[model samples]
Target: MPETGSGRRTLPTVADTEAFGRELAADLRPGDLVILDGPLGAGKTALTRGIAAGLGVQGRVSSPTFIIARQHRAGDHPGAIPMVHVDAYRLGGDLDELDALDLDTDLNHAVVVVEWGLGVVEHLTDRHLRIQLHREPESDVRTIVWEWIS
Candidate 1:
């Protein structure tokens, strides 16, 4: 919460992964872009659930793989931050496809979380939080590394 910069953390359970997300979410704000890089069955979605929870967005938070992107409005709640969850796994060679979502329009008013968005969404912003999650062999635990670029 004190702008700790970049570091790594190990989560032993699904809940732990989400909790870690909540912890990381403490410093998030509108226009924040979080790129989650990891393999299938990794804790990418789980961590995003925690982030959405911390943002005070309503409704169930799930992977938007099929739909590609899901917008969670902050509603009438004062101080609530809106969220845009995107799945870049299905994107092709051109990330310019992201242009169709019009993310730039509300970027200053929403938190954008993209799964498998490494090389795909870097052009969105120069400042962002990059989180990479990796699963341990035969273990439910996951190792998450984070970097905050300004």
Candidate 2:
């Protein structure tokens, strides 16, 4: 695993990547944004699953590609905030369409995680944690890079 700059971690397997997401969720606050960057099958959704677990969300966690956005409320975990998972793969050239979804309503009281969010929704906020996942050649391994930008 390779890392650039400071405070970044590389995960070796899908489970590790998800575990990292859980750890990250523990440190997230209301209004926190997470942008996931990766090609197809790079385990972006798997990471989000970890995030939901960390946030004390129950039930199953799946990619909301067809629905655009899905909200999950915190369960037994104390002080746990809501989790808003967004799949930007279907988004067109403009983000206005996303704005129309009323995602902003939960922006201040939930943690928003967007997959395929590289250029489309990167500007939604000034502060966010960017997670980039890449695959290793000829292996089931993946390299995950995390950066906190404010």
Candidate 3:
């Protein structure tokens, strides 16, 4: 089993982070909400990129910081679903401005990955997977904690 942030397990490299993401992706479904919390350069986008790959989404998976969000459609697989990636870093204060963007309407059909998502977007759904990334001080390592709440 993978360790949470409170545990001693550490992520030594970028590939480990991506691999952990792929493992987590196996449990995802449409309408699933993922909230990612981390500081700058903590590999939030890297994990999302791994998720996109796991979901069979082709093309590049880049940060949507400037554009707010980006959608990636699954290819080849008939039952594949879509993914909605959102960046909440730019939305200061409350998420009213972010909510005004009408992302709730798209929540039904795609897997939503919200970066810098903490208190702002947690109320969007009662059920969600919250991932917290922490950087280690002694080394270039990271610790990711995934919590499934319903």
Candidate 4:
């Protein structure tokens, strides 16, 4: 879990994608923003589920597409950070809609993960972990490339 700066991984299954997320979560903390960029069926929500597990947050982790966002409270652990999972695809590049989510405020106490958040949510923080998941053609494999942008 050392900050090696950046790395990429190939996941052959959905479980592998989530496990990779758990490993990545070891390096995360409150006030951290993680932007997941990818197309449909890229396993972004699955990855977030792993992150939520690693963070010990309570609640069922699922895609927030319909509601746009979902908040998962931290479990019984003292000082555990909460999680706010958001789907920015529906925003349609609307800054006003993005601002309404008030993600910056959530960053004060939770780990914010946004699917399809690449260009839209970067302004919420000066630094963020950007992970891109790309599904291979005609296969279940996914390639994840991640880096910390400051």
CA lDDT of 142 in candidate 1?
98
- What is the per-residue lDDT of model 1 for residues 49-144, given as tens digits with 9 covering 90 to 100? 999888888889999989999999885667778999999888864556778877776587999999999987877876888999999988889999
From the highest lDDT down, the ranking of the candidates is: 4, 1, 2, 3
Q: Give the distance in Å from residue 92's predicted Cα in candidate 1 to where it truly belongs.
A: 2.0
lDDT (Cα, tens digit) per residue for candidate 4, span 73-117: 999987556899999999989999889999999999999999999
- The residue-level lDDT of candidate 2 at 105 comes to 70
Q: Candidate 1: where is the Cα deviation over 4 Å?
A: 2-4, 75-78
Q: Candidate 4: count the clashes.
A: 0
Q: Write the per-residue lDDT of candidate 2 for residues 1-108, one digit (tens) a residue.
A: 112232656677888978987887778777888889999888899999999888887668899999988888878768777899999888864578888866667778
lDDT tens per residue, model 3, 72-141: 9886887566788999888864567887867677788888999998877877876888888887765658
> Top TM-score: which candidate number?
4
Model 3 regions lying over 4 Å from their true place: 1-9
Global CA lDDT computed for model 1: 0.86
Better of 1 and 2 by lDDT: 1
How many backbone clashes does every candidate have? 0, 0, 0, 0
